[model samples]
Target: MSVYQVLERWGIKNYRVIDKKAIEEITLGASILATGGGGDPEIGLLWTLGTLARGKDVVLIHPEDIPDEVVGASVGCLGAPIVLTEKPPSQNVLEKAFKQLSSYLNKDLEVVIPFECGGVNSTVAYAIAGELGIPVVDVDGMNRAFPELHQTSWVANGSHASPAVSVDDRGNMTIIDTKEDNIRAETIARSAAMAYGGISWKASYPLTGKEIKEKSILYSQSIAWEIGKAVKKARESHRDPIEEVMKKLKETREVDSFRVFNGKIVDIDRDFGGEATKGFSSGRIRMEGIGKYKNQIAEIDFQNEWLRLKVDGETLCLPPDLIAILDNETGEPIRTDIMKYGYRGSILLIPAQERMRTKRGLEIFGPSYFGYEEEYVPVEKIVSKKGCQK
Candidate 1:
């Protein structure tokens, strides 16, 4: 069935038309919610906006409406966000990635799911759908954003991210078809991205519609839209937009967003040397906790996304969850590419959902996977136990 018919049945007649202005706002909101990783929004936006100018519609489909038999996959650029900032994507990246993957699989794709709700990955899915004359699913792997490729709801549910096809703007392509192990797929793709100069176009996670419905986060686009609208409203009214967003997402209750550091970024230590070698960005950020957090210290270690967060020598946050650094003045999210010394921001923490805490999910993204000595602990339990919040 058509995506339009499905939305109609759901009483959602008007899916937000992502025009130029709306796309900008949506991208900003998505970036803020991206939790410090998703890739460059500008690159993703330019590609998507160009596709829109071609007079094709990017339709969104509800998860449940997709038939079980139809094959679906996600399309986006994969590589160092730093590299993307320097080398903008060619307009044909998504089309080429999808085409190559489809040819490799020897099957026509029925739908494209956005890997995440951020600016680039979110809209890139629609651009590919428009090019291929397919519908983009309304749901996504993550309602917020995560750093790693395997951290999707699909992986948590047992669908594999293997056989991922990655292509460069130069038309070079590589297909990774490992058995069900996403980390292996990540390693292969990361190597390809490095070989291709730190950035590569990727189409991944080919699954059936039924598999997507069962495993994916449904109606997440609607949730992002709501969060975006709330932020916009908060901005216009001169209120704390961050608080408004936190309230809307119920993120405060879910996890404690420490006003940990309000100071300038004193230094940034990047482990990968921005080489894009390992499919992950390894780095540490040092910030002097300012304002109410004055005279305090905050440091974050990252591998792709922020892994461990420490404030004043106390481990405040950990992985399998999210930590976002935003512009204190404007509330705009700071990307790893643009994060620099003297950039003042707040550290917001939100708990990972129960779905991500499954044995399988933990096995993939647990503390041990990242070399932390402690075992995986739910954010709620950790926060409550430490008295970080009442």
Candidate 2:
């Protein structure tokens, strides 16, 4: 069915038709919410922009509007963000991955879903939809950014990311469906990325429209658009954008908003640098936390996404939640690549949604996954006890 018919069926009249300008704004907002973990937006944006320039229309459709029998999947780049920054993706990487996977399954896909609502992944899904003349679902696996492959509602509800296809800029491809485990799928994909010069193209979670409606986080694109709009408004009025974000998200918790040091990065410690860590990008960050927080210290450890936050040995935040270090002046988020010891930025902490706190969710992305012996503590509680949350 046509995308218009689907939208009509769902009674969703507020959906935004993504033109070039809207795409830019959405990508910027996604990068900020990514909390220093989603792959570079420039690559994803440029790819989508190029497709539009070629006269292709990238249409977004509500999940419920889709036909129950239509097959759908998500397409994006996976591997280290650092690697993606250094090596650009080939123009046809996602298409190649999709084609190979479909050929392997002897099935044709009718729609595309964004795996996460971040810069690269979000726009990449739309680009694929545009290229293939398929409708792009307005939902995703994770409403927010996450690190691991299986750290999504799809996996939490028992759906698999298997039968995934990975491709490289050089046109080399690898399909991994033999391993049913999500971590093992990630491991194999990571190794393929290493072999393909650190970044690998991927198409995963092949499912039907009915399965997507049941398992996916619907209307996530609308959420990102609303968050982006609120931030921009706050900036124009000289209001606190973070506060505005919290208010819009209905998040009542408060956390310390640390000040930026000197606005320049001085050092970064990337763990597992020699590939012994099995495709994981582990690292620690130390910043001066200057300005109002000047002379204070801010230390953060990350395994994919920011895992822990501390200031002079006092715990500020932990995993299964979100912590972001952003530019104090522009309110732009500072990623790991741009993060330095002398870099000046504000630190913001937010709690993870309840969807990510279920028993299965915790077991997949809890503190234990990161080698921490302590039990998982919700960010709200930690901040509340410290009086950060009022």
Candidate 3:
């Protein structure tokens, strides 16, 4: 069905047709929101752009616009972000996963949802939607990216990622149905990715429209779009993109954003091809203070995504909250997959969305889940206590 036909049949009045420019903007905003994970945007951008060039329609609809019974699932790439840079996904990888998951579920998906918001993952849903003639939902499991499959608003709010389907480029497929054990599903999925040479495209987390409205991050796609639009305008007008991002967040998300540090990367310690770190990019980065932060040091640890941030031995940001290292001049995210020494960036921190602050959310992806001994603390609290402004 055509995009208009789909919306009309569903009786949805408010919708947007995503163009190449919009996807590019969404990718940029989602890359920052990815908090240093989500792999590279270029891969997803190129795929999505190619889809658009083929005259396919990518329609985005709000959760409320659909019926309560409308079915959907998430589509994304899983594995080490760095490995994705080496082995870009082949065409039709996610399509195979989507089909397998739908067949396993015995239901036709009416829409596509992003597993997380990141560069490649953010665009995956749109590309698939365009391919399958389905609309893409503005909702997502995680407004930002996380490394593991279990870390999602869907799992935190009583949905399961069971009956998930993962596919590798060589046509190898695995259907993981852990029922309610999302953690086990995550482990199995990771193992599959490692076995497949480090990356797999996946379709999982089937949910109803009502479940999505209740359990997922609402309007997340729009949030990323607005952030991207704001940054684009800033670049065009010669204004500071980071400042523009903060303003846009205040307007759209009503959240406080902080610039916690300014520095140049001094060292990166990574573990690749290790059994303990298989299917993941585990690393720590150290930075030398610059500008007003002179003489101080900043450090961040990551498992595909930035998990913790500390400045001179004082912890400022923890898991579930957001940590983004962005270029000072362009505000483009300095992704962990492509980070290098001598790169300059300004650390930006934003509070995780309220949905991710639930008690179950903390248990799954918060500080303690990441092996931090400290309890979970809100980013706003840390910023207020320390005055994280420059």
The residue-by-residue lDDT of candidate 3 on 1-390, one tens digit each, is 776787888888888999989999999999989999998888988998999999999999988887899889999988888789888988999999999899998898888988888889999889999999889999888899999998999989899988899999899999999999999999999899988998888999989989999999999999999999988998999999999889888899998899989999999999753468877889899999998999999999999999999999999999899999988888899988888999999999999999999999999999999899998889899889998872
Please state every model's RMSD to the true fold in angstroms: 3.0, 3.2, 1.0
Clashing pairs in 2: 260-345, 261-344, 263-344, 264-342, 264-343, 265-340, 266-341, 266-342, 267-341
Clashing pairs in 1: none
What overall lDDT goes with each candidate model?
Answer: 0.73, 0.74, 0.91
Q: Please, what are the lDDT tens digits per residue for candidate 2 over residues 1-390? A: 555554566455644467897777777767776767777888888998998899877778778877788788888877777777778887888999998888887888778889886658888887887788767888888766776677788887778888899999787989989545988887788788778766788998888878898888777776666667777888899987766665655632222332222323445788532377554567888776455556667678876567788776777777777777766556677776556556666777766656667788888877887787778888777766766532
TM-score versus the correct structure, for each prediction? 0.90, 0.89, 0.98
lDDT of 1 by residue, 12-65 (tens): 554545567666666676677677777777767777777789876667656776
Runs in model 3 lying further than 4 Å from the true structure: none
Arranged by lDDT, best first? 3, 2, 1
| Number of the top-ranking candidate, with lDDT as the measure | 3
Evaluation by lDDT, superior candidate among 1 and 3: 3
Candidate 2 stretches greater than 4 Å from native: 1-15, 251-267, 271-274, 291-295
TM-score of 2: 0.89
TM value for model 3: 0.98
